[model samples]
Target: MDQRSELSEFLRSRRARLKPEDVGLRDHGRHRRVPGLRREELAQLAGVSVAYYTRLEQGNAQNVSVEVLDAIGRALRLNDIEQDHLTHLAKGKAKKKRAAACRPQQVRPALQQLMDSMDHVPAHLIGRRLDILGWNRMAAALLGDMSQLPPQERNLARHVFLDPASRSLYVDWHGKAIDVVSILRLCAGCYPNDPQLTALVGELSVKSEEFRTMWAAHTVAEKGHGVRRLRHPVVGELTLAYETLKLPDEHDLSLVTFHAEPGSASEESLRLLGSWSADQPVRTG
Candidate 1:
């Protein structure tokens, strides 16, 4: 969870993905020891000195200006999320490190009621570290039975990486795994000193090679909106549109909901799943 290491790796990974030709630098077909743009090539593209760029890449963001960082980000062709992540890493060193909140996360009664009102939609309130704080019966039906899991084990990343059933559940399990790692990377940048996050990363790295590889890539992401394809054990194939709603609270919790297109086969499958979930015990967590 070293911020310096994270910064350096993020920058290095970004740099390694770019080529001299990508930034209008002519590749003079010369022998090179590495792929992508070299440090000097990146500095030239960013309109900065090699030494200065090297120092910045070495995690020395002390007194670095936003313009300089933006220049670097531009040279790397960073997307919006990547640029935001770069900015977070650069400016994060200025803040004092503090321990992560130790309190257990809980869903507000109002929010829980709101989730319950969505009878057919699958909703889960996800807290920091991708912890599944609260979930509705529909979510439990679509996903697994979270009520049966210990509170500590109800996490999206853990479920994706550790659970064997998750592989078959997600149609594109590799993509799902990458998304989990990217989300965790975003969380890590926001809270570098979070012991729980550190432990989660360590555990996944040791247990799953795919998690380790994706985590090393440092692809940061924000929960927004996307489509999810799943092969449910009971309902067969389904395509669910996922959306995240951020909660206004001390804990960084967001309600994630999945929906199916109206009048589609997926919606019918969802209805069947809802019916199946109705008979099973409702999720209490």
Candidate 2:
């Protein structure tokens, strides 16, 4: 992907989502050509020159300072994830060349044991491209049997977009799909030259129209702690809160654990699902 073009589009998309009144600016009587605040207005809000902000938005500004970027982020009303994404885009051009082939990341046995110990909490390990590197039995029960899928098909983004079962698995499929695409966009900025990521994006873009449209929006988001409503085949609907923990030493591997509030129906359902998963034959690869 062209980093400059991606950066330009991302900034434009964010800028278009905000209005003059959003930042307490009075709406002028003049007819506006664009949807959001004009370039000059944004520049004024960010305390930068119109020409400099314009150049930054156009992807021509090569030396972006942290303070200036932070000001722009605040002016744009960006969240923490979006702010991080902006920083990534600004620095992405300086990334060195990666290896021709992306190396497969292995889950540590200790980490696997840790996941297994959380018997009631559905947990899984995901690599850079959202690949399901490892998962516990409860995770398999909640999100479908990852062991049944080929390694290449074990990506969360792939399953969310291509797998028909995912439509039934996630209660808010469209919303989840949008979040997945945004996460992928953030990943793309971080690893602009990863061939595997490029291939995955190309494949999904061709296969799913929804994925294609969301991908084109240029939104970027880091995966964070959130609640998800999932429909289990056996246990019906479950409202689970999940936390994404990034492993510092694991080469972009993250452990995502899902659980439910105590004494809730979802908690009971999760316990039942855990029992059911425990009864099934343990899967070995």
Which regions of candidate 2 deviate over 4 angstroms? Answer: 93-101, 282-285
lDDT of 1 by residue, 36-70 (tens): 78999899888899999999999998888999999
- Model 2 lDDT per residue over 34-59, tens place: 89889999999999999999998998
Instruction: Measure candidate 1: CA RMSD.
Output: 1.6
Give the winner by lDDT: 1
CA lDDT of each prediction against the hidden true structure: 0.88, 0.86
TM-score to native of every candidate shown: 0.95, 0.91
Work out candidate 2's RMSD over C-alphas.
2.2
lDDT of 2: 0.86
